[model samples]
Target: MKRIISQCSKELSQFKRDRLTLALAFLLPLITLFIFGFAIRLEAKNIPLVIQDYDRSPISQRYVAKLFATNQFIFVPWSVNDSVEIALDRAIAKAGIIIPPEFSRRIAAGNIADVQVLVDGTDSNNARVIKNSIKATTNDFMQSEGLIPETNLLTTRSRLWFNPARQESLYIVPGVYAVVLWIFPSLLSAIAMVREKERQTILQVYASSMTSTELILGKGLAYLIVSLGIALVVMGIGAIVFRLSFAGDPTPLLVAIPIYLWASVMFGTMLGTRTTNQNAAVQGVALVGFLTALLLSGFIYPLSNIPFPLSLLPNVIPARYFIEITRDAYVRGTGWIGVWFAELMIFAIGMFFFNVARRVLSKMQLTE
Candidate 1:
């Protein structure tokens, strides 16, 4: 026990001695939380909208005013000064409302008329939301002005829930935590362990009575604790500084964290054994981390949106489950019942990799 404790202390001391790794250990998670939380918001609000009103009539003016009055549209322009197509092409605006030259003249004549709306389809999600908001806004204006069809049609309206304000931060913050934590812990551990092997430190331990399992466990555990501390700090900054709301209970997040940390350390161990230099280790971590985060994280394109076979890919990505567990606890506020399967999977993967680590390290020949 004393020897293991000494080994752990020495490992941690070695970790602290490296300024870059130490700074990354503390700073990376916080930086990821802030960047992903603010940048990748789920809800589309205040999208830039342009109006090309050619009619110059009271009814058209009223329509324009009503559209701008809604908080949804950031009305950047209110004239047909620039072409609608050009505005969209230049990405200056998302949606364009073009009122016909005879809009008010026809309204005065009690003739039913329609306006042409041009929406930029660059971002499908943004396009969808802006189109929906504009449609609702227009429909409401028509109803208020009694512009109803003589043939009545039944209509249904559905309200979006949970993220009532449609704030992107709500959806993003939880996922950000999962991706950043997943990458940092595994990358750090992989490099750290490999560095020990390169320095002949693993040989020194093996020369003593320490088993390969003990060496791996000691190294993995120390990194896991460090990861937990970093997770807490990242969560704190997200909740306090960025004003991200964690709606769910924290018990599931607490429970699932160590499981994730374990899996990460095991993965790091696997990578560490494969790489030759610190550069190779860092590169391996970055490549795997970015690719896994992009494909498996379910932050950019949702798992449901992907094809059936591709959805299975997320299961292999540890961060995907971590995101699920984090969202269940923080957003839905659920307990073990909500995320038991994810917790189990992480544990199973961790154990599987640990076994592999034991085998690999036992066979590994290190020199003094």
Candidate 2:
């Protein structure tokens, strides 16, 4: 016990002495949280809309007013001589509405009036939202003006579950926590071990009376505690800055975080043993662990949306499972029954990596 404590103390002291590592351990998570939180928003607002009204009628003006009433679009003035294509080409407007000549006359005669809508498809997501808003606004105008009967052909109401307001921050903040834990703990541990190897200090440990198991535990435990503190800081930032809510029981999340951190530390330790230098260790952790978590861990995209063999790839990514566990605990508020399987999977993976790293250390000790 004394030897393990000494090892833990030694690693902590080393971490404190290294200014770069200490900054990364504490500041990286906060920086990542702020960047992703403020920058990546899904909701579309204030889309630029240009109108070419050839009709110049009261009805045409009313239609334009109704569309702008939704606050989803801002009207950009267009003259009859100005071309719609020019506005789109110059990026002055995302969409253009053209009310053809005799529009009010055609409506009065009970004949279909043609309206042309030109949309810039460069950003498909924003274009889709703008199209839907226009459709809803037109429908409301038709109903209010007695152009359409009050009785609808099909009336539909949607009830959103879990996140009723559908705020992007609600979905993103929890995933950011997964990303922070995935990157920092692994990077810190990998650099620590590789630095020791580079300095030839690992030889002293190999010759010491302390077993390989104690060495691994002592080093891992220290980082694990530091990582947990980082996680709490991230969660607090999310709650305070983004107004993220913990809707469900937080027990599963509390339990799963350390388990994920264990897997991360062991994975880093294994990479450290394979690499010859701290640079290689950092590169390996970033390419193998951080990028995998960022892209494939169901963070930015849905697993179901990704097809066949690609969808199956996330099964091997530990962050995918941790992200699921986090969402279940913080967003859905599920109990152990909901998250036990994911928790077990993380534990199994952690144990596998931990044992592999222990074996490598044991071999190193024997050979030295």
Top candidate on TM-score is 2
Residue pairs clashing, model 2: 248-333
Clashing residue pairs, candidate 1?
41-168, 42-168, 248-330, 248-333, 249-333
The residue-by-residue lDDT of candidate 2 on 1-368, one tens digit each, is: 88888888989888889898778988988999999878877678888999999998999999988988888889898777999989999999999999999999999999998888989999987889888888888888888889997787998888987887777887887788888888899888888888889999999988888898998888888888778888888888778998876777888888898899989888888788778898899999999998889889988888887888888888877898898887886678777888888888888888888898889889988999
Task: State the lDDT at 68 in candidate 1.
Answer: 81
Worst ten in a row by lDDT for model 2: 326-335
Predicted candidate 1 versus true structure: per-residue lDDT over 1-368, tens digit per residue:
66666667877888888999888898877877777877775667787888888887877888888898887789776445668888888888888888889897787789877899899997888888888888988898888777877457887768875666666666777788878887888888888888886887777777888877778778887888889888889888887865776576777778888888888888888788777788888888889876777666786678888787777777778788788887776567667788888888888878887888778787874432
lDDT of each: 0.80, 0.86
Error of 2 at 61 (Å): 2.3
What are the root-mean-square deviations of the candidates from the true structure over C-alphas?
2.7, 2.0
Q: In model 1, what lDDT does residue 165 have?
A: 69
Residue 368's lDDT within candidate 1 is: 29
